[model samples]
Target chain A: MSIRARIDALFPRLASEQQFPTQGQTIFVDLERQEVRRAWIPHRVVTQLLGGRGVNMFLLHNLLDEALEPIHPEVPLIFGTGILTSMVPSASRGNVTSWSPESRVLMDSNAGDYFPSFMKLNGIDHLVLYGKAPKWTLLHFEGDQPKFVDAAPFMGLDNIDLRAKIANDFSGVEGKDYGLAAITTAGENLVLCSGIMAGPKAIYARGGPGAKMGALNLKAVLIQGRSADLSTARPHKLRNRDVAVKLLNTSVVKNALKKRGTPFLYKPSRMLGAMGTKNNQETTWTDKLDAENIDPYRPGMEGCFACPVNCRPLNDMSVLGESGVGSRESETPAVDHVAATPDTRQPTPIPDKYVKGDGPEYVTLGKFGPNVGITEVTQVLRLNNICNDLGLDTASTGSAISWAMELYQRGMITREQTQIDLEWGNYETIERLLFMTAKREGFGDVIADSSQAVATGKYPRESLDYLMAVKGLTQSDPHDARILKAFALGLAVATRGMDHLRNRVTLEINAKINDSPDFKAELYGGPVSAEPNSYEGKETAVRRCENIYAVGDSVGMCRFTTKLFNSPSLPGYEEFADQVANVTGIELTNEAIDHIGLNVMGVERLINAKLGITRADDTLPKRWFEEAIGVGPYKGEKIDRGEFDKMLSRFYAISNLTEEGVPKPEWREELEGVLTA
Target chain B: MLQTESRVTVRLPEPLREGRGDVITMNATSLGDIIAELDLADDRDELFNFAVNGDLVLHGEKDVALKYGDEVEIVVAFAGG
Candidate 1:
């Protein structure tokens, strides 16, 4: 049978009666042809893939030509909603999938509440954008027909402004709903770090989707629907209201996410010594935390559709500057790092006053702050805002900029070539480069090429020595390989280059707080210090973490809430499977759920393997072994290369991979079948 | 001759809050000596320099002497992203 026929057959055989309407809509738009094609994705396939992110990944893997570079224009841009999206209380998530320009691998971002509701109400469970538009066009999905409208006037607005205009344009149009995901000038410019914003606060902010759109000259696609059938009430009634209520009333879910937003990882991460400091330095801050503005307790806590815990803090920024822009609050460890620096812009007898805002989330703060040698919070925020407006990925942009600064300071690069005088804590020069990079003007163009490209003999390779990135993706935070051995190994081997979010094995070493201390100690060995240095059981911890994270991503839930709030251990595998079965009405098992998670991870691995990724690409920088932190708790310590190799060997052993850490052909076969068919 | 020892005050982590009652007081002739006297072995290496009377202590061949009523603060490097 053909691939499509096989996919069609698997649907009814696998799905429950109520999981999907027999005739649910699938809309495909050909921008070149300016034609719309509609079909039905049977309920079985949706149930097997678990809808939304899971389904999107499966489809993209099958349809895309091969493991093409993430930035290739031929790769399909998929916008999909999950089984839980329109109905379940906590099911407001939409998944966007494409080959990532930043990581150079398949990248996906989940936007909550807005995208899912809008897509579902428009009678589309999946919307695929393939081929480039001849001109800038708006994709309007109303009822069963998809229309193409000119989007010239709405081209250059920022997220806030674009959302307002789109709302007004579609206000009285029959059958549409609230929320829009639109690209900004950053996308139009095709900067590799751009993103798309959905609604006001929800953003698909990673891996350069905006740049991809810019390359295609496809401005924006607005998804809106007013079909009351898209209401949350539908899925709630199907799953039995008790299940939805139980999820909301779970106290464990509420308390954990309230205070820190996602940076709650700070305390445990600090203890493990994984927290990035002074650009991955050995020291940690020891002082009383500012208690007044802890995030969760702050007013106007907001959450996704049905979630009880509103983890996002609302900051009334009327107090900040004349812009009167109030920001939704979040925190990152970089805030303190940046805050510690003295502002260079101030005159003699410099005033202590500085700009402060919600966060320097871990990724941006780490790269812009310690990584760049500027510890001033105001400077970090300025850099953060500049990158955001320019549509740059803060992590990659900051790491690249900081690497350039370090290279200049070390005499590796000439001042004439850099244009700006580079120095640590020099905000003026850094600010100028941020603008230049966004415009890809002069020296900024060189910086925009990323550290990997620079390392290719464009500059002295010695300068790339200090750059802490892998596979083109810079490390989100500095982690000592000697300390968190498992996380180190995981980072080295992660398919999407060096990333913390893809595989967080560090949690296993620091699992005590997630569970009871006594139990974790017994499982891993003696009570490991909050530090990630102890090698004992590090491999096992990392393996478990990778599997759980993979499952969370495939299921279309945010990893923060899934791992932290709703732990895999909370309801056991069987109970978790039952929850899926109850929600999608597909009788699944603990083993089957595991298979699905492993399948998603395996497909990603296959893509990388086809691209010839191997143990060579999995290595950390040589500087990690040679350089020692100048001061603090681990001042003299360096990661032992021998220990890292041993850890990798053990990790491969546990994961059923070869000595080179490659998954076996049998493993690939199992996963490929699920993804392709 | 009347004898007196130089004093340094150290802030404690929250868990150690009860014992210090605010800031712990210690006595020695210099910043290094005062930190050693506290018996805080784990935190001993963290003190990079001292802030005496709100000014940073600078590197010099001769150790600076502390005087009565002079406020001394020791700064330690801590981890954050």
Candidate 2:
């Protein structure tokens, strides 16, 4: 078959439907040459590498001709969706793919928002960009046709203002008619912590994709209009989505999310005495920062597109609405707003203009709450509000700030260098630093860089002691690795640097309730080989979770609902295969699904190898091994290096990679052949 | 299959309340007793970790002895946000 013919065949759709199942026409635009060429990814690519991060990896590997920085003009910026996104439940995911200016590796960041469904509904599943814009531009999509409008007016605007100005321009169209992605000034300044915003809330908030867009001088991708010729799909595949919907309706655990938001993490982690506080140095906190504390402010429960579970807490942060700099069009907005904003909400004395807020999820709570020693729930909301406006990633920003706070306490970074009398848990100082960091002013400029770079520049060698990072990225998920052994292992081996989204072992030595041999065999497909504290069976558990998560990311499904081992009713690899087969007319058995995941994994390993990542990089931070958690039930707890090595070796063996974390020649050859694009 | 005549106040988070109320007075001595008393026995998903006065009952049944007025917080287990 011809490449286009193969691409057509891969996405099987309903004959009754007039549109392509993959949605959107494929086109490549070179900004420098001002050329827009029609292009299509042979469906063979999706079959070989799957979609989302997997497909992104394969395409980027083949496209890059020379070793250029992520912000280099020659690099391509790619946006992709999974085969199942907008076709199935909770698949409201859109991914941005590029070499990360932060980690300097080909990376993809996924966000759940209205924007992705707009792409799917509009038939623009895959969009690619090249060269640098001669002038700032906004790529507006009406179906597949894009008009590159001058974006000079939108330049230097915060994420919220950019979204609002554009949304207001098209306000007559209604809220659901369009989806937009834009950047803040931080991205324009090339701040390593910057991210791409989708809608006013959801963010592709990791790996500095914003910096790449900023370098392109591309302001936005505004997608509007439905596919006049809608993509068709086999009704049988879509009918299978009922399985997920029914499961969602009946599941008991899904209710927890609906009721409490991600704040559910607070109660359990606190009960185990394993919550993050004052960075990783402490993992316990006072009861005031508990998940339940948000009760007064949490008004409504919201959800992503097509999802039944409304897991996000809609907070009436109107008090905080005026607290942001987004309201002002030009110049620094916060210094004025900070003084002008006032609190009408009483009891806790939270200051105003930062309200009408959306989230203070677990990461926000942990990072801004316990991690920084602020027990006040409202202050965390302030942090969330600030980060959301300035286009900063809450996880990394929190980690970076907390890491610095730890340094200051130990007398490593004094006030002379920091320009603030930095102290642990000082909410006022913490809030001040957030503004400065976002603006890249004063000491904030030093911190806007990677924590490792900051440590190298400002602190002594011993200062690396408490920096909980892997592969130069700060640890975002606030879990202390010493307590959640498998999570720690996931951070080390995951393709993304220091991320837990790739894999999480729900059952582990730490949570050893499922230790029976029969039960282990039933769930894990193996014998009860190791205890929670032992290194024996952890590798098997982590590898299994990673592949399932890999498939979830590729399909654009939410992993919280799909692969959760904590639940009695998680959709497994078999279910994933069934959905893929039903939706795309691709018949994938359980083995094929596993193979696809492995194929994706192998490609990432190859890419990382090409980027010079090694087995040593596939290791945890010194904090996990050297410093025992100072407080908590798991006090004086640290990972055993010997045990960690055993687990790492097991992981390498499973991935078909060498001990040095590089894919073996045969493995590379197999992946290379799979990259038929 | 032990005699259960003890009384305990089991506090349920909103998700598990079945629209009754957050606080429930049930006859229970052990974790199994609480599960059975709530009539959650047949549908017992073991969905939560039992905590008595902020410490987890690592062992499920009767691991931590219940006392009068001791607040039991049922926490749902999750990996990340």
Candidate 3:
């Protein structure tokens, strides 16, 4: 098809004011029947839901049947691009939505880079799959035409090798490069904690979407298309430059991200007495994992497509041991310190050549480092690399391992149950457990689904109190929330369980914002919203943070590029509306945008309600309230139950939900109208 | 009036280092005094969250008194990841 013909075919309902397709066509695939279908994203839905995560939630709420199992053939698996995707800078996000096989709740995992943009270039906004393939299959779209090929040869390959092999095979095919969303050996083996590898550094690395894809017998989704031509979008030169300049000048972007990537946050986190240490029994540890110490391991930095802030670090594997700076030859003694046993495990050979990969983000660093009692930066990097290549969610994997280690420390779990001695900071044992978990081998099956799975029936009732999880999903944020009321509340009530990407009020730490009471009231509905430890105004803060984050996720904007992450000068709700107007000629007031965010939350609640989640599930783990933080400047800090309950009630009232945390019937009916229309 | 001689080591974030190393020694009785001594007390509330010997001292608690050889870390509020 000609380019114009293809565009017309894909976006039949394209609006006149739109210089380019804003919300492109939806492609539905029936893997069982090998059938393909297409439809335009209705204008009404676009206006209300605003595509990406919002539209994904809308579609899933209307189409998904809760009776079906998470990996059932009839269950819908959806991938969608945000409305602003490919039309603006740092807006390359694509969302993968489905019922999580791990968390057993509605899950939306998002990432950025070439994949979403490539999907748009091929004239697709959302791709929904139903039913299962007969065998392991690769779904390849060659310039908007779909093909199914045998994927037998690609099975069991690690993520890096898998991408390389596919690229090598498709190297000279009409000189077109392919965009891949693939899984590795972990997913192929149906590991419950596996994630979908989207790009070099972007992974849909939560909620086990990879296992769902594996269950569908879908090995990979590949898109081959011509490079995107920027002229059609008619991007404003001065506005783009202005945004670029603002980002470049931001102190956090310049000093923290541009210097050492996300891992730089590790020191601050430790200093705040917030970093979760030794399975959260403490909040600080050895300073060996400090950002300055890890400087030599970082070769350079990179960024997502069109993102000026290159927050991703390229870690050099060559600088990990005896040959590198700050090498700890004495620390590598082949003996288990806790068990006092000779370490019989053989060391994996380091590559002689210089090797590099993206990672050791703050979450991964903390989860693998202090939380598990492994203070060595090299060990954390090694574990992170293994997870990336094996298609495992690093946060969940680290949480599970740490929980087991704590159990072992208490003499609750013996070597007989674990088969291997579960000692704190034993890198070899941790490594072995990771492999075993990915393959679901032997005792690995007991804990592969995360600590929630391990606690139920397998462990004693008291053990349930110690598993730091909400609604089956383990907490991903490394910062201890007990001292920070806002963070604590956010973790308790986030839609996708304990993950911070959902609704964290990160600005609570900024003492300067507290001085501007007017701004605080406008954003968070109260004058005193910025205090971290205060119960006053916390409910409003959490509610407002969730709403704005909903807008960010829906518009395909990175949280790092917005006020949601750090910089106050970046785009907020008002600026976002302006951006939408500039890109698509869609004039929406900031209030309307905020309403859209509220509607997104409503739709998500409806979906979760169907899955039997309610106010009871919106609570912190027992440990947060029962046990005070044993160490830290914030010693004796614990969540006050009465205060937390009052906060929840206030949040529910503001969200137009009932005291039970369910959306009222009228709001639900209104949201249902948006979904069905 | 008798005066207390308080000596402490202060650690600052990269940007706030200002050609000085990450760690610097100062003699001050309180966090406010330290901030003033370092010439950082002017309109820099957002840039700091002070901690003395790993204990958090909030904006309201800047009057938190210091002692001899206390290690103070000027923790930045914004942790980007």
Q: List the candidates' TM-scores in order.
A: 0.75, 0.89, 0.90
Name the lDDT of candidate 3: 0.74
Deviation from truth (RMSD, Å), model 3: 5.1
Predictions' DockQ, in order: 0.05, 0.36, 0.42
TM-score of chain A of 1: 0.80
Candidate 2 displacement at residue A536 in angstroms: 2.8
The CAPRI class of candidate 3 is acceptable
Highest TM-score model number: 3
Please tell me what DockQ candidate 3 reaches. 0.42
Sort by TM-score, best first: 3, 2, 1
Clashing pairs in 3: none
For model 1, residues A573-642, the per-residue Cα lDDT tens digits are 3434554555545666766765565555556666666556666777776666777645433445567888
lDDT of model 2 at position A228? 38
- The candidate that wins on DockQ is 3
Candidate number that wins on DockQ, 2 or 3: 3
- For all the candidates, what are their Cα RMSDs to the real structure? 9.4, 5.3, 5.1
- Model 2 chain A, TM-score vs. native: 0.90
